[model samples]
Target: MKDSFAQLDLTTEGFRLLFEATWIQRPAGLTATATAGEWRAVRTPDELAAWALAWSDGDEDEAALFRPELLADPATTVVAGHDPDGRVLGGAVLSESGTVTGVSNLFAAGDTDPAQVWSGCLGLIASDRPVVGYESGDDLTAALAAGFQETGPLRVWLDA
Candidate 1:
């Protein structure tokens, strides 16, 4: 389970901390740097499948996590960034809530600057509401560079 606020203690319940990350938030109307790739929403199942492949780096087992039903949800948008030749280079999943848009599953191809992916994603979303997400290590750095601020700590737990 995900402890978004890092306020829960579950050790006694047989849950162990799996990992920790920082919650990031980008205020409304902030612009990210432009990237050479183009970003667009995944409107079709085929596009979402392709995006899943790219996001999972061709790992079929991992790709199966993103079901096609997500596309039918008006509040969820699967975005893909492609190169000039139409090769999906990066992507993200945006889930809109009442007051904020949550970004998740952000990924990029080999050697691609994550900042580019974040920039392209922000451009494609173009939402007036704030964008929120979580990350660790290099990804967190990239998000920070893309105008996101560290809001708080988060933790993931695994049942033992």
Candidate 2:
């Protein structure tokens, strides 16, 4: 079940194993310290614009998809990291607060590690709930190191 990457048959047992493998966790004692690792909005119009751009892969049209109301929703957590002095390092969007979360827009300052940023974000919301996301390349690596497991993959089609 654990090493079924090659034996993935999607059988009942395979599905069960796949389900069990997908998860996220904060390393022991590796969570936030008050406001240092807090989850909040981007804090400025410019920052929000940048975050939206990153979330949309530099597509300004897709960036426009995120409205202020949606970004500030009580349920959606679109957050950026800050030092004690409060500098905007990076941020992410963790959605579906009530159930399994989907992570996105994982960007951070070069000085900070994206995986660690994700860990702190997940700690704020993970709370023993499962977190899911579409990841590839380095993002996929970061996800795995952040305690996520490979369940499968994803695809998206543009209708416009």
lDDT score at residue 51, model 1, on the 0-100 scale: 95
Q: How close to the true structure is residue 7 of candidate 1, measured as C-alpha lDDT? A: 96
How far residue 60's Cα lies from its native spot in candidate 2, in Å, is: 6.9
lDDT of 2 by residue, 1-160 (tens): 3332334444543243222222233333333333335456565567777667755557899889777776566667777766675665567887875556677667765566667676667656645566766566766777777766776544332222
With candidate 1 superimposed using the best TM-score fit, by how many Å does residue 57's alpha carbon deviate from the native? 1.7
Clashing residue pairs found in predicted model 2: none
Give per-residue lDDT, candidate 1, residue 22.
100
The weakest ten consecutive residues by lDDT in model 1 span 29-38
Q: 65-146, model 1: which lDDT tens digit per residue?
A: 9889999999999998889999998989999899889999999876778988999999876657899999999999999999
lDDT of 2: 0.60
lDDT of each: 0.91, 0.60
Candidate with the greatest TM-score versus the true structure? 1
